[model samples]
Target chain A: MITMIELAESIYEVIKDYRNHDNIFITPENIIEWAKQFEDNGQLVLTELNKIIKETYISRVRAKEFIYEHILSYLKLYEYSSIAQFLIDTEFIDVQQIHKSQPAILQLLEEVLTEKFQVSYLPYKGFPKVNYIYFDDILASGSTIGRDLVIFLNKKNSSGQKFYQLIQSNEIKLSISVFCLHTWGFEFQKYRIQKEFNDKVLKKINWFWNYEIQNHAKFNNQKLNIAKPVKGSSSKINSYLENLSATKYEDYAYRKANTPTTEHFFTSAENRIRFENVLTEKGIDIINMIKGEAKSNIRPLGLINPQYKIFGLGTHFFTWRNIPNNSPLVYWWEVAGHNWKPLFPVANRGN
Target chain B: MKPSIRTYQIKDVVTFAKTNGEFGALSNMAAGFNLFINEVNIQSSEILYQACRFPLFPHIQEEIVRTQNPMDAKKVSRKYMQYSRQDWYSIKFKIMKWCLEVKLVQNFDNFSQILLATENKVIVEYSTKDAVWGAIPQDDKTMLVGQNALGRLLMELRERVKANVINKSTIIFPPNIPAFLLFGCPIEEVRNDDYFIVDLDEIYA
Candidate 1:
């Protein structure tokens, strides 16, 4: 069994930033005890797993820099050219917003932009319709943006005329400037938008983002074949992958990625205890957990209830703000008596 | 922390190939770039150039492929496994060596010296006789197309390499064996047949 001292040392080695300080959630001392819970046959060999947990973490420092360095700097450049008029998604303007969760990024953007540019939300009424730039942190499926655009365009004005109707009649051109796009989602939505609208409507869109990772169909197919079980563990992660039947999650297209995303593998303090309890009961059959054919006691993304066609586990995205629910049940989903702990603790649980 | 899976981006591949004088690969890349342009109508190789710079994350790659209606994820998996088993560097060297001997590439010595110079510049100094066409152009149109294609390829390479020289990490590519196949394969033929742009705006729109 690895000692608390050993676990702390291992964590420090990987998370160089946390050597002197504790993370917002898991501290080195806390992680040591947490590591003990995943012991297999009374042998706690979570050294590598601990390393993974630390490596996957994106501290607030890094997250802020990503926003400022990549996204905002580019936006500022446009502002300098006097061509940019910033608009945010209307969802950020919530009526019931507590603790100012709404428009936090916008507020930050405003502070950073330093009054050089204008940032506002829609029903952009009385404002001169310039190059309206919409900002969002991430785009996983592109469905969110599509839905948002549909809503924005369909919104009826005071005279009962919809914005989209006017645009369709060539009364006004609705040019969408998307920043921070996930390329796969972008392509999928791009195809849909073009099909939904005619050639003229499709011409007025521009996309600028930090980077687009490999999510093309051609590239992902190759990755699926090589997706392996996590190395050096007692869990049946590898066996589960090998035995996963094609028939399972057959209808849900997105679940087919085979390997769960690396981002979802961290353990929160609360989840660590619950997952350990489940681990004691289920005894490490990750494949069965994923299959979820017979057992109810599984991870959040694990239950495969067929509403979303969610694969039981794995997502590629990571953010400092919170672990996405779309990730595997083991990553963010936590429920008591289920013995389900998550790698990253979900923020605003039960919301 | 667990190390994320390392991926080779297009930029890394071009940097290596350009620096090492893999003329055949450049030809294939140029053809692919041309195909991408013909489909998308982008004036520059910036998309593929940018894509080349993007990392090839297996998780995203697997997800994207599986989502296809035909779902040839298994074939992709098999190919990936095959690639993992081979020595990537050895394969790269062998392919380059073969291309040189077969004259699929010309002006290797001159190109290599320029590429390897301390200043880190690519100087392509060649005469008309140095042309190593994959096949003889039968008509003026074909010859013009060939020249334009090669010209575009060379220009893009110089610009891309200059922009990307700062990436210090060494990268390797999966050998496109039967090296002639690499040069001859059109981008359209290799890309997902179902996935095509209905309108140029469908891509960026």
Candidate 2:
């Protein structure tokens, strides 16, 4: 068995060749130790994890093409519908807070979707607004869309129409278009929106996903169930999850499905303190624990969303520009002069 | 004739509820709590059995039978959100809170009857210090969704289950009457008069 230090060295060898603009903090050493503590069946080695990171990492070119083609096709299909008449007056929205910060895909959409359909940025145009499509990269818990909608609803447009008034008067419809959507998140949003809004307003809402992941953790889907911790680890993980703070509504967003492996071990720097306390209580160093006999619970998935019950590690989805905040805090959270480094640096929010 | 009746423990009910259908016996949990919850109507307390309760917890339901396929696996997550023992207690507490908030029942006895409505396959016998109020049907085809109902509507369900199951028990109580009953199934194949009770008191204790 490789020591934690050795494992870190091996990991460094693999990641060294990859791009590094903003230096990520967590070393291969930090990860190996964390993994040893978290995974029960301790067979995972540095080489395997390195392989997963290299293979799963999404590059800028691939992400742009995937978004452009999927959105373009979705728009083409809707072009012939009677709703097209209403949609021609549609306005594209920044639902994910990505328009200014992570604008590569959005720019691509503007180039292709705008050219294909008669679209406008502002609502001041004489055409009656019929459709509003909010674009984002991922939808994990599904609350962000509702949150953005609340923001949009309160803003008065150049036309002096409250977005909420347009929605109430049946003058406009709302929809969400995304690249990745989890099954549980989609249903939660569906039930929540239905319960909150009237039928007419609900009827005008739509959800479209380029890739609909049916990883709800309930079914016997072997591929998706890969994250379930076996016996010894299962109990430890369960207790850890059960004890997490459930103070917020989003914190309560848990389903029976196996917690996605993509969720990170820690959500943020503050979350790390509590997680470290659990390790301290165990009184086991990274190198001395018994070797695991089961499959590692961690997934090779690239992205993490701390909002997910997993403390922050989520599914393997990633984008080219910046790693999402949803990814494990270990990979993305960084403070000046801090030992912790983000493997995938996030886009500067000021942009 | 009266509908056959039996008693079960909540622990056994939890086990039976988790048996997975297609994965072979003991391979997977049959279905989650959501499948059972969808069939219940708390406000009306109306018992519905057919596609929802056919064979009273068959690997498949009427909808699955008619569709000739298993229920969509994706839906199980949304309906059966409880994953652990604590999760189950949390959901039960939610139902209890809802019952109280909605004024579904005035007292704890009637409120406890809501527990009888936990599963699709149930034998509910409602009574008080004086008389037996009503009982759910025991048949291969029919079962109860709600443990007890308050009015002419539940009277109708009781009649339907009894008639369809070829039993002849009449509704004996008035609406808003308070009563309690135990829910259970046979331990194995037994006579209509015989049943194996799960000793819910001990299990809960």
Candidate 3:
């Protein structure tokens, strides 16, 4: 009958000789010995074997860990003064801090507007005079944010014009300031202007308000009609907007216990210790045992209806021309029911 | 021992011809006869027994009936006239040679055994399960093609067996037949009931 030892041997050969890497050598014989030791120490089931392999080999590193160790260090030396200063001085800024920071920035902008030009704070009764838009870090693939920004800008610009007409006779300019200007914002602004005035403009609009459009020709000629139907469009958009609105002013706690680098180092060390402990308890040198098992030839279990007929014993012998006499005799023997066990030379020694 | 002669139907003749690669030649030779294997002559004597169904040439049926006595070899040969004697004999020789070569026949006590032996050496009849030609009747032209294919296959098997290419038998069953005809070798009916039986002893003897 096929035993756990055989399975362990096969698995060990597969894993050890994987990709022919010289550094990673785990033989079948050694693995079998290790498994026997584990069984002797009271670990019996194959599920336990799977657990041991997972604990020993599979490395665990979360997405958040990647973000902290690799992403944060590069972000520290950002050219933007305010964002860098904020991260350095406060250690971290949560959503609430973002809300607080926005108002202070706006207050500074208001002061600048007042001192620099004739400005009026015309608070529209129906819509709030001050509007804020929040986004996560690095807004490329502007498809999502572009749509939101366009709607907001269009509403604010239209309302700002109406407010100017109501409050002042002279043209009053409007300004937009975001926490960080993404590298591709200029392309998005150009795209918006070209889309809005697609048919009306004789030549493509080269500039949008004061933002100098980079890749203006590319944006102008772009065929930005909805390429394909978005999946679950109505529900997905509604839920995303709802979540953004709910968490607009919420505060998230920031605690740096250990960066992922140190955490991963500790994790590797812990895994090594656990492996060593298990090996010591079992009293098996795993690598050597697997090698030994691989070299041993196991006997095959025999066929169900054994067909053995000896004809013309002393006469002319006839054998198939194709099959060589020296070739290994491999046979499958039925063990219990439908299952068949393959016995190798070692197992078939007496037979 | 009485040598029994059995008459075969057109379908059976076609099948034998196909398996032996003589269908085309046989069909051409047997044209206008309306039947095949007319007056089965054993040794030099024509067997005259109404109990056994006999194939008769359409033109000589009246002559055969009036004679009442078994015709001489010359007379029987004349009555069972083939369109082309040379072509007919050549095709017959080729088919008979092929049958001998493939060991489709096994001799028991000097008689050619029509039924092949199973793995246990038990005589297996040429039923729908074992007989390659026992199936539905095909047109004369198609029968010719089938005969030719069977003949070629038999020759190949003969060479392999002789050389001992493999100890085991390597006969391939015919494929691509209508479901109804898929079961067995085609057989000719005599008197609409009597079926042809392979006589193993006579051929070997």
Per-candidate Cα RMSD to the true structure, in Å, reads: 17.1, 16.0, 38.0
Residues B1-205 of candidate 3 have per-residue lDDT tens digits of 1112222243333233221233321211211111111111111012211101122232243344334333342364464565223333324333333223322211111111121111112111112231222222334422221123332343344354446652223332222222111001121111100111111011111
Expressed as tens digits, the lDDT of each residue in B85-196 for candidate 2 is: 2333223322222222222121112222332343343323222221122223334323322232221222243344434531212211221211111011111111110010
Better of 2 and 3 by lDDT: 2
Q: Each model's interface RMSD (Å)?
A: 12.7, 17.0, 41.5
lDDT for B178 in candidate 3 is 22
Chain A only, candidate 3, TM-score: 0.20
TM-score of chain B of each: 0.20, 0.17, 0.21
Off by over 4 Å in 3: A1-101, A110-149, A156-174, A178-180, A196-351, B1-205
Shift in Å, residue B192, candidate 3: 79
Candidate whose TM-score is highest = 2
Ranking by DockQ: 1, 2, 3
> Relative to the unseen true structure, what is the C-alpha lDDT of residue B5 in candidate 3, on a scale of 0 to 100?
22
Across residues A263-313, which tens digit of lDDT does each residue of candidate 3 receive?
A: 221123333233323322221122123333411111110100111110000
Write down the worst ten-residue block by lDDT for model 1 chain A: A222-231
Q: Give the share of true interchain contacts found in each model.
A: 0.05, 0.00, 0.00
lDDT digits (tens) for residues B116-159 of candidate 1: 34133222212233222211223341231112223233444444
Q: What TM value does the first chain of each candidate achieve?
A: 0.56, 0.57, 0.20
